[model samples]
Target chain A: MSNKEFEQQLQRSVAQLTKEIQPQRDLWPGIEHALNHEQDSQPKSNSWAFQSMAAAFLMIGLFGWLGFNQMQGGDRTEQLVTVLSEPYQQQKQRLLASYANQPALTDNWQQQVQELDDAAAAIKLALKEEPDNPALLKMLKQVYQQQIDLIERVHAPAWQTI
Target chain B: MQTQGQLVDAQEHFAERAVLNLIEAVKAGDKQAYQMLYQQHLGQVYALCYRLTADRALAEDVTQEVFIQLWRKLDNFRGEAKFRTWLHSVTSNVCVSYLRKQRGWWQRMFNLENSEAMHEVAPGSAGEVDLDSLVQRLPERARMVFVLHAIEGYRHEEIAQIMDMAVGSSKAQFHRAKQLLSEWMGYEQ
Candidate 1:
């Protein structure tokens, strides 16, 4: 037989090929299980973010108060720092617990919060040498507020926009 | 009254619309709608997977992976192309990736001499051969090129892109596939 005739026979056979074939077993159960497993593990994966943020905030508050005592300038600075941080730490813990089940709106919100905590720590370290330094106190206050704003923004009801 | 051709067209249109609705529901996170879509397309996806992988068990695993990926990526479909076309593209990519990950299995099967690869002869006259069985017997690249280009209606350019080879190589593999298939079918030059 010529190549042309052979090609025609091949084409006919190709055209006759079935487009669908049923699998010997049901595959949907496996796929559904995988998808559900993914959904179930999502919150557990985000648990690390919650832990990191909580640890960062605790360190900043602890370091700030410790620095106030080290300076020994006056009891007023220690009192003020304690007043500012005590309630803030309580609120932070509450918010983290409440939002533990919810996925964060942003991937790097925890990182941003950690950076702010680092800034707060450095300011507190400076305050240790000059406890009455108003500029450093203001800066520390700004950092703390920024952390609160970030946490609130990430878990806000309007998070869909973010 | 509609003509027979018109009636068939209307039915097809209705089916197409139903599939689009299911896609929209799936994008909205409706699991039932996704299951409906799965039941509707599993056979077609499995067929592509089976032909591409050339192994029943591997095909089953690849088919499941394809659906899992479909669930994750259904949101990316912008309706610019027919869903089935997009799905076939997805299945082809998944099969290629899955096969690449199972390179050891492919190496074992590639040695067709030791591999009990082509045992299912077509159930017909003694000389009649199943094209799919013959395709499974072809060298891996040749089988992939022929299946994509001839059976799946992919152009050599598209096959090259999908298989990550040069277009010339795609054409060469296809030519080699045709020659082997013709020879296996007992056709002379």
Candidate 2:
């Protein structure tokens, strides 16, 4: 059992080894689901960039008009903000729904997330009163980004030591 | 379940034209083309991941991750590198990132006592055992180096870059891996 002979024997054994090992399960289904999920998650138009810009302008104008009236003291900012942001709300809802059942990484992640959701709710409540506040819109976007980051981190791939 | 290396080496690189065509279609957002590529590469990718991670389910999971990444980043493939080479690079990065994310405190704690850790020995006679099973029994860093060096044909310097270790470390780990495999084979005899 000299080192040289051992090395030669190990080399021979490895040379005979198969480099391709088939998975026991049909991995195609999982891959298919992921591909489809990605397609579903993305905005579904080549013109979405222009469309989103146009939509954003329209929303800003509408919210600005509502806020102006509220300053003059009218009361429909609630309904208007909801109408303007309906699409984004649906997108967020769908995002939340997809990962709803995934396990969280930290024990306090849910509570931390709950605090973010509460902030989001409070921001929406304020938007209903003063819908055109740029600061508020920016805050809402940040909250959304945080939620997405949190969920993605929780579901991130890890080494399967097992 | 042919290896991608076999595909690359076959007949002046088998299916180079077909793979190029698939890449074109994939760049155009063809899901079918992507799936075709996935099927062609899954076994090799899974085997690579398994050797790196030493777990079947994780190998499959990482294989799926590799494809998902390929689909997302297919537009960045400029045909400068061979698709197989590009793919192995991507799989290597995906495995590296996977290892990084698993360094969470709780996971490290759990793995210390985890019964199902990669060191689990399957019940079988040594002669009946597969090379992959034996490779998985090597220590983690050694297993990664052996697969990247021996099976994947990476030079120690290249493995150093991929695994982010010194070249000598890669060489040493590879030798350690071979020695472990030798011991296992001697036991079988």
Q: What DockQ does candidate 1 score? A: 0.24
Per-residue lDDT tens digits for candidate 2, residues A19-109, read 6778887777656665665543344332333454665677788777776766432236455546445755554465457667754333455
How high is the DockQ of candidate 2?
A: 0.22
lDDT tens digits, residues A61-124, model 1?
7767666677556565666566656655676677788778765544567887798778777777
Clashing pairs in 2: none
For each candidate, give the TM-score of chain B.
Answer: 0.87, 0.78
Worst 10 residues of 1 chain A by lDDT: A153-162
Per-residue lDDT tens digits for candidate 1, residues B1-189, read: 469889999898898889999999999999999999999999899999888878787788778778877888888888788889989989888788666544433253235423454334424322455788788877777888888899999999988888889999999998988876766776766
| lDDT value, residue B133 of candidate 1 | 79
Against the hidden reference, what TM-scores do the models get? 0.61, 0.59
